[model samples]
Target: MIEGFTSSLAEVNGTRLHYVAGGQGDPVVLLPGWPRTWYQFHKIIPLLAQRYRVIAVDLRGMGDSDSPLPGTTRRPWPAIYTS
Candidate 1:
């Protein structure tokens, strides 16, 4: 919710993932640890946005992202981050 940051939902691996992006320059992805969400970086997101394009994501089963049920097969998730 920072001034310049924009939040969005993306369909990745058949899951709806939530993320916030802002600023410019090289991309910087922020992945929260277990039981956490992108809000964890609320304080620093704006600061880092000053120098880089910051992207904070809410991983599967966390935050605004859709949680996949157990035993379900999913495409590789890392591919979304790598490219």
Candidate 2:
């Protein structure tokens, strides 16, 4: 409910990821660095949305995205980030 943006949850590799998307055009995915959530791009979303479909996501173990279970291997971390 952030103006023109829409929030959603996606399940990938058994993990649920949270994201906000808006605008229409070529797709643009935004991934925030550690300790930050999708809201970090709030101020710029509107500007980017004008020319492209902006999708800001909350990476795993941060924000509303599900955290990995204790003892889980970190090997998949790279795949998660790239995908």
Candidate 3:
């Protein structure tokens, strides 16, 4: 057997974000796509736990977090876009 990690909810910028935390290095924010859950990164989490403090989160309207109605486009976008 092995030690376990933890998951919880965090309210950020009005959205209730669900997150899983582990490891012990620089903060690494794992932002998923619009329709995907944080579980998509389950495979990489362990590898990351070896070197980084991994934090995988379910974006607003996805997964364990609260799914609210659509909002204006002025809000934040996923971290993938380089603009």
Candidate 4:
């Protein structure tokens, strides 16, 4: 766990999404690239969190987030990322 960061799971389209959040003020959502987890932002999170609320998310099927079942249709990026 990163210092000063809190981990959480959010339900989106019946899947559990993992994320780490911290700090205050305006919210800043960090989306990682392919094959990467929220931990990728560990170094920058603290710096950004100093002035903004940082939320680093692990995209589905990547980190601790749930993976879609085989044969299921893949959702679009907009739908998957939207709250």
Candidate 5:
């Protein structure tokens, strides 16, 4: 919940992905490392947003994004995020 930034959810690849976006210009996507959520970039988002359209996403099963069903392991990551 950083100032000037807004969060939203998008349905992609049959899953809902959560993201926080702000600013304008060329796009910049931020993905947190393992065991972390978009909040990991909360401190740097505003700075980056000053010069680019920053999008910090909560990967599936993290933060506000939906979790996959147990034993599910066939979904392709790139397809889910790109499409």
Candidate 6:
């Protein structure tokens, strides 16, 4: 898991998403299991950050992310860069 930073929120598909970003070489995205947050990646983030810009995101309704309202649209493609 990655470390050294707190999970932050980002707007994605019109919803606030929880995430943590670090490192400097290249952009890398990491996702955790259900009920888990970006914090789950804490142990690995620092090591990865040394070589790439690591980003771990909390899935909707989990962790620091805004509680997802019922019936919210599905957004399972965080791996695809939107911005």
Q: What TM-score would each prediction reach against the true structure?
A: 0.85, 0.89, 0.75, 0.90, 0.90, 0.75
Worst 10 residues of 5 by lDDT: 68-77
Range of the 10 consecutive residues with the lowest summed lDDT in candidate 2: 74-83
Ranking by TM-score: 4, 5, 2, 1, 3, 6
List model 5 lDDT by residue over 21-54, tens digit each.
Answer: 9999999999988678999998888899899999
Candidate 6 structure quality by residue, lDDT tens digits, 1-83 = 33455557788666688788878888999888988887787777888888998889877778877775566545444532264
Q: For model 6, where is the 10-residue window of minimal lDDT?
A: 72-81
Q: Candidate 2: misplaced stretches above 4 Å? A: 81-83
Clashing pairs in 2: none
Model 5 alpha-carbon miss at residue 25, Å: 1.1
Per-residue lDDT of 9-59 in model 4, one digit per residue for the tens? 999867789999999999999999989999998889999989999999998
Model 6 has a clash total of 9
Clashes of 5: 0
Scored by lDDT, model 3 comes in at: 0.73
Candidate 5 vs. true structure, TM-score: 0.90
RMSD of 2: 1.6
Position 34, candidate 3: lDDT: 66
Which pairs clash inside model 4?
none
Once model 6 is optimally superposed onto the true structure by TM-score, how far is the C-alpha of residue 69 displaced, in angstroms?
2.1
lDDT of each: 0.87, 0.88, 0.73, 0.88, 0.88, 0.73
Q: In model 1, what is the error at residue 39, expressed in angstroms?
A: 0.4
C-alpha displacement of 69 in model 5, angstroms?
3.2
Writing each residue's lDDT as its tens digit, candidate 3 over 25-69 gives 997878877689778888888888888888888876678987664
lDDT of 6 at 53: 85
Error of 1 at 62 (Å): 0.8
How do the residues 1-83 of candidate 1 rate in per-residue lDDT, one tens digit apiece?
78988989998756789999999999999999989999999999988989999999998889999887566536466754443
